[model samples]
Target chain A: MAKTLTQEFTKGLWEEIAPFRLVLGLCPVLGVTTTVENGIGMGLATTFVLVFSNLLVASLRNIIPSKVRIACFIIIIATFVVVTELLMQAFAYTLFLKLGVFIPLIVVNCIVLGRAEAFASKNSITLSIADGLGIGIGFTLSLAALGSLRELFGANNLTIWTTPTSVIGVQEVFGPHFQPFSFMVQAPGAFVCLGLMLCIMNLLGSK
Target chain B: MRELIKMVIVLTVLAVLSGGLLSGFRNATAARIEVQQLKFVKGPAITAILKGVSNDPIEDRFAIKDGETERKVFVGKFDDKANTVVLESFGKGYGGDIGLMVAINMEDDTIVGAAVTTHSETPGLGARAKGDPGFVSQFKSLSINDSFKVTADGGRVNAMSGATITSRAVCAAATEAGGIYQRMKPQLIEKLKEFNK
Candidate 1:
């Protein structure tokens, strides 16, 4: 039986939520969320990669040999990542530098491949698109949530928009003295933020 | 036989698709990637020093000399009034090279400002290099005559509680970069005129 479209669109929120429930793509979810800007850049870049890879993979799912499907998934995801990385460089160069290796690392994010293997292959093109969208949004939201907490607690203020200084007035509140959270921006803080967020998510889900 | 033929065709198609995609992406984003690398790593340092100049820093190329060691400086720009040159410098820290961009002012031959690009110092210890702008801000308004050394080293720079090594490395790089730019001052002015013209 053909499943309803709603299921496809809603699967990523609670069921596959990338980092929390599915436990996939946690590396990036934890690694990049030091501040709001880093988290947003990382999330958007991942979403771009995820959406494009899913679309292409589902379209070519049947043609891809089962034995070489993993290879194909990697290529498709890498292509999208490169494209997104370039776009970020051209337009938002500063944010792009801040994100660093994580942009390329998106190729290995399990969420992209997981969707291709679990859902895209079985679904229609439109449904696959929906699934990709849902999952991408979920991942981005998770990153931003983690980033906001880190930025607020780690730093005095949050810097979401990554311009030089002329963003929706982040400088006004934070001013020049506003310092970033040294630990939160580093590797250790990634685990802490994700762990705490995951706990809270679990608690909220139970309630 | 038919299945074998189909599998070969599929594999061939995948290879062609991947190759085609990778080549296109590499070509399209190569320049952009280069620019981004310049902006983040070196851009802020230029801004910190050239705060008053109407024009953007000269982000073409330059050089930094440390003792006998010389490294090519890229994405560099020059300002005419201050007769300064901003270049990328890598200071040796506990973990690795601490990347910084320093502005050399020509008037008094002082370092105007420096913006750190990257570092791997221990958190709350060496990482204070970034967290404490005081560590970085000290670079502004200081001249070569002042001696860019930490207070412990008989200079004005104040080392952080835990990041004595990193602070010293930064001071060393800033000092070296300032020395090199002073020698290159005449050429820098000529180059700035050439670039602007």
Candidate 2:
């Protein structure tokens, strides 16, 4: 069945959210989500890349030969990733420093490649853009949710954003008496947190 | 035969276009990126090393051509006289290169302060060189001409516990800064004169 434009856009939010539903692009989901600020910054950078790459891939889908399409998609995706890196370095240097290698790794993000190959290349430009925005926003929300869960338990604070001069966030939600579970911010913590979120997602979906 | 030619042509065009576009964007953002780095990465280190100075070291900076490389030299004004200059040098660390910013008092040719600007050393171990002030504070008041070495290598500086390699790397960077200062003393003095006016 041919779906309407709104359906195409809304499907990514819940039905095919990258991290939870589709479970694609888990590297940044786990790696950079140690803090809420890092998660949002990383997500926005990835979204910028996704939207542009989808737009280009869909536009050039006809011109791109089948045999070399993957290579073409990569070239397109890589260009946007570098653009993101450079812009982040110029404007958001602090976030750029935090994101570091993960910025460039967006080129290899399966969500980007998978979308370009499966949806963008075959779909119309408007539909491709809708899909890209939907999936990208979904990915960002997932990272933020997971980041808040980990940071709340691990550090006893929620950092919304960090400017050069001041940090904008709640300093201590649990108050002074609460001792933070430091393990929730570490590598193993990421895995456990992700698993629990997945379980919760599955339980909700089962209904 | 036609299909093969089409593939080659399509790939070549896409690669060339992507390269041209990225290179253009990189050139446009290069200057802004440098300013951002100075502000976020190197600025704090310079300020910490040149503390109590009457002027901002980051703003009162000049570049000197040392051999083939042009090095940035930040000037600090003390009591209405610009007598100290900070130079950055890098040494190989456990994981990668560690950048050390060394400040020298031109009047006495002695070290003012040294701080790590950028590094990729192991967290809690080698990274203590930057995170902890105890290690770098020892570089103060030493003659800029002297070569630095850790206690394990028969020198006065003590290596951080469990981070001997990082300590040595910092020592090497300080030594390098000393060499650069000695080599460029005359030019640096002239540059400081420009800032005084």
Candidate 3:
């Protein structure tokens, strides 16, 4: 039975939610999630790459030989990543620099590659686009949530972005006198928070 | 043989297509990207260091050929005369290269200001090099002839607490900038003539 387009789009939000249910692409989730802004920026950039690549892969699926498909997919994905990189550098230089190597690393992000191979390669172009959007948003939301949690606990405030002449985009979730845990923004804290969140998600899903 | 030939042709076509697309994008966004870099990344640091200058440094910048690379130097103008030149230098840091922008007063051969433009130092530690103005402010008014080093190395500047390595990196970058200034002094003096009122 063929799944409906809406189902394909909606499933990624929860059933196949990346970094949680799917457990795909944990690098940026842990790395960039120290701040909500970084998470959002990284997520949107990934989403752009995912949608275009998925569209291209699905439309060319029949013509792309199975033996060379992986190579072809990578080339297509790399092309989109380059375009995204240049555009971000031009328009969002601060976010671009903050994201650093992660932007270029999006080329190999398993989420993008996974969609290309598992969903896009076999699905229609329209379906693939839906899957990309669904999965990308799911990933973005997860990153933002994790980032906000970590930032709140670690730094006593949520850092949105730092600009010249002002440290803008930060909100004091905790009072000024509060001594933040601080470790929540570090590497170990990322693992602990992500692990706890995943456990909670599993507990809810099981019930 | 047929299968291999087909694969080769397919790969070659994809390469050509990707190459063309990327080059087109690079061409389209090249100028904008340069401006963006200066505006958000380097511009703030230059402006912070070159405070009180009348002309916009970003618009009044020029690149000078230095060895094999063209170094873009932002000029600060006062009363319609260029009086300062800001250049970037890099030093190896904890994670990677730390980029430092050093502004020089052409009139007195002293540093107007210095700031860290980019660094990959650890957050709350070495990263303070970029955030802590006090750490960089020590560079102000220092003679270009002075060896820019942190106090740990018997120099006037103090290292950011718990970030000595990063502190040293910034100093190293400033030292290099001083060297570049010495080498380019004559060119900079001649270049300033263009902006003279």
Real A-B contacts recovered, model 3: 0.81
Model 2 compared with the native: what TM-score?
Answer: 0.84
Q: Please tell me the TM-score of chain A for candidate 1.
A: 0.89
| Candidate 2 lDDT over residue span B37-107, tens digit each | 89988999898888899998888889999999999999999998999999999999998999999999999
User: Each prediction's DockQ?
Assistant: 0.36, 0.79, 0.66
Ranking by DockQ: 2, 3, 1
Ten residues in a row with the worst lDDT in model 1 chain B?
A: B73-82
Looking at candidate 1 chain A, the ten consecutive residues that score lowest on lDDT are A167-176
2 versus 3: better TM-score goes to: 2
lDDT of 1 by residue, A1-207 (tens): 676777766777667788887778888777778777787778778777777888888999888877777877777777788778778878888787667667878888888888888877776788888888888888888888888877776765678785676764153245667665678766787788788877887898787
TM-score of each: 0.63, 0.84, 0.76
Tens digits of lDDT, candidate 2, A1-207? 687789988998999999998888999999999999999999899889999999999999999999989999999999999999999988999998888779989999999999999999999899999999999988999999999999999999999999978999998999989999999999999999999999999999999
- Model 3 per-residue lDDT tens digits across residues A79-190: 9999999999888888888888799889999999999999999999999999999999899889988998998888877766665456666677767888888789899999
Tell me, by DockQ, which candidate is best.
2
| N/CA/C clash count, model 1 | 4
